[model samples]
Target chain A: MTNTIANIDKEEDYFLNLGPQHPSTHGVLRLLVNLRGEVVKDLKPYCGYIHRGIEKMCERNTYPQIIHLTDRLDYLSAHQNNEAVCLLVEKALGVEVSDRVKYIRTIMSELSRIASHLLWWSAFGMDLGALTTFFYGLRDREHILDIFEETTGGRLLQSYNCPGGVMYDIHPNFQKRVKECLVHLKKKLPEYDKLLTGNVIFKNRAIGVGLLSKEDAISFGVTGPSGRGSGFSCDIRKLEPYSAYDKVQFDEIIRTECDSMARYKNRIDEFYQSMSIIEQLIDNIPDGDYQTKMKPIIKLPEGQYYQRVESSRGEFGVFVESRGEKNPYRIKFRSPNLANLSALDHMVRGQKIADLIAIMGSLDLVIPDIDR
Target chain B: MTNEELKQRIAQLCADAVCTDTQDYVLAEIPANSLFAVAKQLQEQPDTQFDYLYSLTGVDYNPELGVVYHLESTTLHHKITLVAKTADRENARLDSVCELWKTAELQEREVYDLLGITFNNHPDMRRLLLDEEWHGHPLRKDYSNPQLIVDLIK
Candidate 1:
């Protein structure tokens, strides 16, 4: 090693390949980072190291069969993506979902959002150098997944959403188990705040780092809590009311600060909001059929339809162009992670190496979601 | 304003652009060249502050091509569908909305990478989610998978 170093010119700049393997990267993301003593001059995020051509696969599958593929896009919050696609197809076919189906889907989506944000909070803390919060966050998340298993029969990739409505009706004890799970999460979330949110070092590491102004955020099409942190009101649930969101009452959380801390605080705030939404929906489980009866051979009209829904990361849109066939003529998924990832080049332009990890965590780039 | 009034107003901006005016939204088709101007006007309007660019996607019309923009105004709470039709399949160049909405940049790149539609003056127009040496735009009808195409030739 010493001989090779001696043979190499001292003036040549060294490029550090940070990941597609680094633990702090959060996913299979590689950074071609130009460094000058830990200060990053240029950072390029190389993805598609995990692309599976999900869009092409969706084209081959039937309308109902594609729901399972959507489950894998953002696996951390599979229910949200699954519901997003199911509702798009339902809207396309002009199918009327039952009231009970709407309430149950609402409950499931919110629960998934809470689980995603909780994991993000823990992982974000760990990225900023706190290791214990990872275990704490995952411990609480396990309870939510257990509840999901009770209802959806799958842990992470819950293919619960179907075209007409859902795969099946909620289990009889679904409400009781979800309520118990909520009680446990509510108790554990406060401990998370105590462990991470108020920590002196965590605040110092995240505050004022990766400051995204409101104008910049809007231009970048950043959504979810990231755009909300910058004070752009981009919540699809609030903007375009889908499923049971119109009937439900919840606050559209916002923060005008537009910094890493604002982003962090927005997720923490969303955890409580998600819990509240789940509680309200679970308590008012309507009595009716779980799915609407539709034609066995489902064919979409020969036209273009675009539907957008809010996912855990941000606005997720499904654009389906049908040629009056069982399968979509052309389908496009505008996953929020991809849109949010676009701002990374601008966001991490002047930050340090350590700051890069913190900012990347704040952006929450799910690699498959981006690649798909 | 009601959906009718918004449609009428957009008609005033581009006569006969409104395609179908449903109860919820008004769909309009603008010339590919006029998309940027119409989108800018929508953003500048007091009543229709379509400041948020929700989604941008390209649709293939066998002999022709089209780009669709779904826009909404958070302040006004109105939704509009703007369509831009290219002259033919060979050349599908539309004015970039990146100057008006930043979200359009990545969206335009995706369309370029997938559908082979070029966005003039896009700041950093490059392959977003694909490899740099990837052969053809995957979403295009004529596109053949590199591996499959290679296997066929052999």
Candidate 2:
């Protein structure tokens, strides 16, 4: 062998920028990856590419006006984001919303959850090279969006939830359309399993990859399916039971596998759980006023109030510090995506560059939520 | 534990700690100096294992800068809020709890970026959501950038 061949440094490492604009990242997140050949030695995620300073804007806007701004963060889980703010205002003002409002809000939230997960499932499949799953996922998601449109008058960012309750009562055909969607979702879910869950290629790429321990999951504040994948039962829906979650019967999906496959399976199972919750509450919506009357000029007493709701991603928290004014002194959104994104570096280290895509897909990060 | 008991437990851990009952959880105000030690006890102590740091927020409270931490114990199913304030807004500093909870690592960086409050022991304490060369913290009450932020009369 030539001396030149022996003299080459095998341990040399190089840096690779995955995104500021890349498809696999799902958003405008930039990952600075340190690589030794194909293996990822370390990864640093650069966020705020889409940061609109939503928190600072919230301080300037009135509480009611701030609801729509939340829609822009995690647009997939827009309904849940609206609800978090509404719930905080309601709690602070001591407004007792009617049961009808509760049922409608709960149903809408679950519909949003299913829609969000469907998009994630489609995108995740595409990330792993299963293209057909995208069509199936989006096609099913349209049913829920139609239901939202008919009632809330907006498809994606409904902003249906006001402080006292929902924007208005559900539409005349709301129950019928929701039932039809549930029936369709139930039939199509098994097809999802057949297409990707059992595929040998997906199994090979997903299983035993990007492992996160239960302790690390908790320490890193990784909630939602990502935390549940590590057998960390941190489901805020089960823990606090806001809105009508306490009234509904649904299991919090937890997996002990602690890998990419586990997180994938957790979200898949959540699809059925979300449907069951809608089924339970759809027919039984109480007949009452949708919204409670409020003073035209709303002002919260001088204090800080925190409210958390289980969004599709994880625990989405809203902390409002009000100084007895219509405009909050300070508003901070404890976005689930930000907490979930923090764990990416920890999970992707030592994994191959290809597996990094699979892990990121499993995390289901909506970058606007992180940057906001 | 009840909020009262939780408040008392935290009081026992740090004598100067001021614990109050919020509508949802116990809110404890720990001095800037004792924040790290009190946080360590809350996590390591068997009775109050607040292992989950769900939310960490930086607030510019006029003359004082504060950080609010929401902690929950998965095993105990209890929650508490801790607030630590630094009066020196000009050069605000607090001990980083990223060592105790890994989630605080990025969150502390965010606090540093948005509010100009620095965490002493953060490993990678850099601007998170903004460019490194960005002029001033936007979230501070006093922060004003005429080009960036348009002031609307309330």
Q: How many residue pairs clash in each candidate?
A: 2, 0
- How would you class the docking of model 1? acceptable
Question: Which interface RMSD values do the candidates have, in the order shown?
Answer: 2.4, 0.7
lDDT of 2 by residue, A161-195 (tens): 99898887888999999898888888999999999
Please identify model 2 stretches exceeding 4 Å from their true place: A1-10, B146-154
Clashing pairs in 1: A19-A30, A219-B102
lDDT tens digits, residue span B43-83, model 1: 99898888777778887766677788888877778888888
Fnat per predicted structure, each in turn:
0.50, 0.77
Candidate 1, which segments miss by more than 4 Å at Cα?
A: A1-17, A34-37, B15-18, B22-24, B149-154
By DockQ, the best candidate is 2
Model 1 TM-score is 0.92
Candidate 2 at residue A14, lDDT? 91
lDDT of 2 by residue, B1-154 (tens): 7788988888887899998877888889999899999899989988889999999999988899999999999889889999999999889999999999999988999999999999998999999999898989999999987554446432
